[model samples]
Target: MTRSTDSWIQQLSTLMGDFYQLLAKMQYLDLDQGTIDYPPYIDPEKSVDTILATQLGINPEAIQLLQRLPYVAAPARWNHGAGDEEFVLYGCFADFRKDGELEESRDPLYASIDPKDESVGWEDEDGQYMRPWYVPLSRLGNHGVVLILNMKNRHLWVIDQEGGCSDPGLSDVDWNEDLVNKNSLDRYPSRPATEVLRDLMQKFISLEWIPGGIHHGYQHHHYKRLYLAHGWPDNFDSPAFNATRQVWEDEERAQYSAERPFQDVDRLELWTQLPTISSQLARCEAENASPAWHAQFQGGSGRIPYESRKAELLARLPGEQQRRQELLRELEQARRDVVGVSGEVRRRREERLRLDGR
Candidate 1:
């Protein structure tokens, strides 16, 4: 092996050791069956001597690096929330080889065209190059990031649906640092497979160490906040958390409905209920004068009664009607102004023509 290759192998070994230790500490191997005897290290160079070797034109160094890492068969349930699942890392590119040639069509990440077609490669609408050799490293349920390695440059990339293998601006020398700084939303380049695995293991450890908090709903903003607060949980399958989140979402929906009772009502439906709403609004306004009503509504700090909302709606109806009338009047005025201007222009043109004729 070249000096650089030797260095990479050594670094990979250290990272693998760290990752193995983390897995052991988390008792992941114990939790999952049939992975106990899985080899801890891979000899990427010699390991690719299989029948399919001739088909895959991948560098031996890349293969060796892939083999050095552990292949997770059954991913452990690390989280129990919706869309938050354990990260499963695996290496399997045999399907890419068919009839002793790279079958680009077999992989969804890559284009369906032939790999030998140098004129084209996988890319987004913006024409940014997406590395075709994306080996899925970890997944959060059905969705997750894939690790792509540039065999020639020996640079690693982490990509997903959100962002493909494109780094914002970071040097290759500090690749691991850049990866560590990346948030769950970011898709950027990182260190090789072993280092990336080690980083993921660290994140898993951090998440496991954090004591479970109040379940937040599964909105993007909520999820982003939670992810920032408590790194993405390795597993979100906690029945308790899931139940809590569901209840929270249900409450939110109910509260939204309570706040906007007329939101679902059509114009005809709203008109039909106006009389009743007006009567309720009057009653609510009258009740507002009483201390008991104030206490019941907690001085208007708590949820506003439906009666109060109805009253507000009734009050705003006339204003909305007046605003519509005002808009109609303005539109008529604008039409008149346009007509007058056109007539004036025509008269001036006629006068000028008459003067020229005279």
Candidate 2:
């Protein structure tokens, strides 16, 4: 990039960094309460809402507690039959515990809830779960949690201003210095964390962080805050850390690429961009009338006939099922979200009316 563009980028990065710091300070000072009123939200099940309220000591509308993280996009290419185009954002504050490898070097921070061994539950009949949890992508100076509220495949993810990915392995996670450098470019690519996190955070803050609006009218909510424990647990040891590391290695591969062969497409930029292009292709293909249109000759009829060879090739494509399923699920969720949100609004309005003796 030209020197002039580079200088502008540096200025922008500095400004964003400063803004991030300001947001952190505001959160610490509990300024969010004054900026927004977190009323209790309504859950699909009233009993679930009650339990959430009891555990959180606030209405469910007030906060959301995420248990697991999924991929905003999957890794571009890994050694798996899982397509090289997609990337997933899964795991808890998992890698931070890095087999306890970094504990000796840096103080070990723990999650409020112990990571459980039970199967992570799904929220839908298709065995999909849509919990909005914050997944940290980097340990950027270890100041705060980098989180994304994956709102059940809705419009977009809601991200926390202070939360970010802390994982060293994630391609999206970058050194702060690199971010500053990129900002210098005319078409400076956004630091993956900043772009992804900032976009998600805005969505989360504006939509109340629940995807599909399923929990919109609920009167209670639960949000998990990443906190620094005063001290580490006495029982935390290498053996436990080793076990956790193994679990991450085994589970991350198994969970996302279980049916596919694993490969090495874990780079962030490639993974994020490729799948998007692929997905659009897939959608266009699905809606297109003739599958063999691509093979048409220069002077051939636009009315191309279906070709078996092409159909076979598509059928053999990797992650075809998963991709189609993801899109369908998102579409379905969008519909349900509209209904759920509207119902909650009506429900809340009625409640207000009753309270006013209407």
Tens-place lDDT per residue, model 1, 7-121, is 8766754664565445544433333443422343354332324334324444456545545544333333233322222332222212121232123212324423343456643
RMSD of every candidate to native, in Å, equals 25.2, 24.3
For model 2, residues 1-358, the per-residue Cα lDDT tens digits are: 3455345334433433443333333121123332211112243321123343333232222122211111111122121211322112221222222323112111112222212212422321222122222222322223332232222221122221234333222436343433322211111113334355455335333433322111223221211111111111222243444344345446544543432211222233244455557756755664563645555632355454456444644654466546655655555554444454344444544553464456
Error of 2 at 252 (Å): 31
Off by over 4 Å in 2: 25-198, 207-358
lDDT of 2: 0.31
In model 2, which range of ten residues has the least summed lDDT?
223-232
Q: Which regions of candidate 1 deviate over 4 angstroms? A: 28-32, 36-49, 74-113, 116-141, 165-198, 208-358
Alpha carbon lDDT of each predicted model: 0.42, 0.31
Model 1, position 63: C-alpha lDDT score? 46
Locate the minimum summed-lDDT window of 10 residues in model 1: 208-217
